[model samples]
Target: MRTIVQQGTRCTALAGYVRPDTLDSALAARAKGLRVAAGCTDLFAAVRGPALSGGILDITAIPELRAISETPEHWRLGATATWSDIRLAPLPPAFDGLKAAARELGAAQVQNAGTLGGNLVNASPAADGAPCLLTLEAEVELASRRGTRRLALGDFLTGPRQTALAEDELLTAVLVPKSAAAGHGAFLKLGARRFLVISIAMAAARLDLDGGRVRHAALAVGACSATARRLPAAEAALAGARADAGLAAAITADLVVPGLSPIDDLRASADYRAAAAVTLLRRAVAGLCTGREAAA
Candidate 1:
């Protein structure tokens, strides 16, 4: 590996940068302890204070790691698929919440550079994408020199800024099953202001209705727990409810109280987040029922 030095910046003693064209090369480099860089939208900001002391493995050039494809069973979103790609893809209505999150991730430039896999691996509690992915029953695909593995999105995230990825493994893809693609989805986020602010509380909902009655429901909330979580109790309550504006009343705050563990942060108090989550949940469910946009 080569050594690098940034002359004018606080970051000094920077290490080598490797851009591999193949997944095999990327995995081999990672196995040797090089820090992986896909879009580097988050990496550059994270390492700005201290110089990168080790080798850098840039995986953006790997062709197989950048495509979004769908199979008979699932939709496969490659690790390097940008938020812009997600917004423009011909996805089903069940992915509407995810698409909405993608549009709200950041400015247009960040959307062009930020990636879905990077977002998941960062594992921030307020990540705009997680709640939508959870409601869609997303899965993560991890690859290493040894082999590959898959884990439920909910299980992959352990806590704030932590994930189940092994050091040598790379998150190669995110998978959404075909069965979960039949529902209508809605996303709602509450922030101090509009555009470009972190969420105080956010909720995503997917509902599959049969003859104006809910056949299946999935509800997830973020920024109020260690990881974004599905409210099984609330989903259970809405399973057979009528798909009308009145459905919002059935989603009482008490049903969601058990799933949240919000903390008092600078953006909002714990109590306020809990209340906002319930309100967002109600709005999301109602939006799905009425075919209206829920996020602002």
Candidate 2:
């Protein structure tokens, strides 16, 4: 452990930098109050005003924390897997929504350096990746010197900028079950403008069709609540519905409106956000249906 003094005009905060090449070492460093840093995309920006207090535990060098792998039952994305890596990985169709979200996360520079674990840990209400991951029914893996634990993505995110991560635990990976990975997916984001803008509202949809009817539906909306939430009512309505434009008709505002708790922000009004979330969800599901049609 190397102690470094961050010099600031107003105040200086002492931070220790530790580059751990192994998972055990990284866990031990985190146990000692060192802030975890993988991509540093968010960490550096956050500490720009205030000097870093506790040192940083850099886990990017750990090979075990950087590999993406698949098992018979699930796909495991390592903590250090960057957005760019996810966008380029050879994943199933169910990950299409996630890949689309990955492409729109900031710019090429940010995506190249921003890791999936960092995005989830940030736990922003408007995070582009959260809606897609929520719809995919992803689970987060947390590890400490004590042992490892898994939490559903919904349970892992408690509120805006908050998560279930313990001080001594490190988010090791994200797991997507095979059942959730067996569908066609689509993502739609509503922003003030086109490129490099935060979402006013965004939706991700995954649909599994059997005999031209919807057998399974997963839909989630973001930027409209303290945390992104799945629309269970709308998903239930879509069951057995024709997997075509007619599927959009089953997704009424009433079904999704109840699940959203939008707040008035500078970017948009609460009512506007609610409306946009409903529209985005309909479009996302429609897009999935259209893509399936095209493929057929």
The lDDT per prediction is 0.85, 0.86
Candidate 2: misplaced stretches above 4 Å? 1-15, 49-51
TM-scores, one per candidate: 0.92, 0.93
Clashing pairs in 2: 16-55
Model 1 residue 48 lDDT?
A: 51
Q: Residue by residue across 1-296, what tens digits does model 1's lDDT show?
A: 11111111111223488787777978988999988777788888888534666778777777677788888888888888889988988888999999999988888998988888898998889989999999989999999999999999999999999999999999999998999988788888888777787888999999988888899999999998889999999999989888888998888878997788887888889899989999999988888877733321
Model 2, range 75-142, lDDT digits (tens) per residue? 88888888888898888899999999998888899998898999999988998888999888999999
Instruction: Assess the local accuracy of residue 108 in candidate 1 as a C-alpha lDDT between 0 and 100.
Output: 91
RMSD of 1: 6.9
Candidate 1: stretches off by over 4 Å: 1-15, 49-51, 292-296
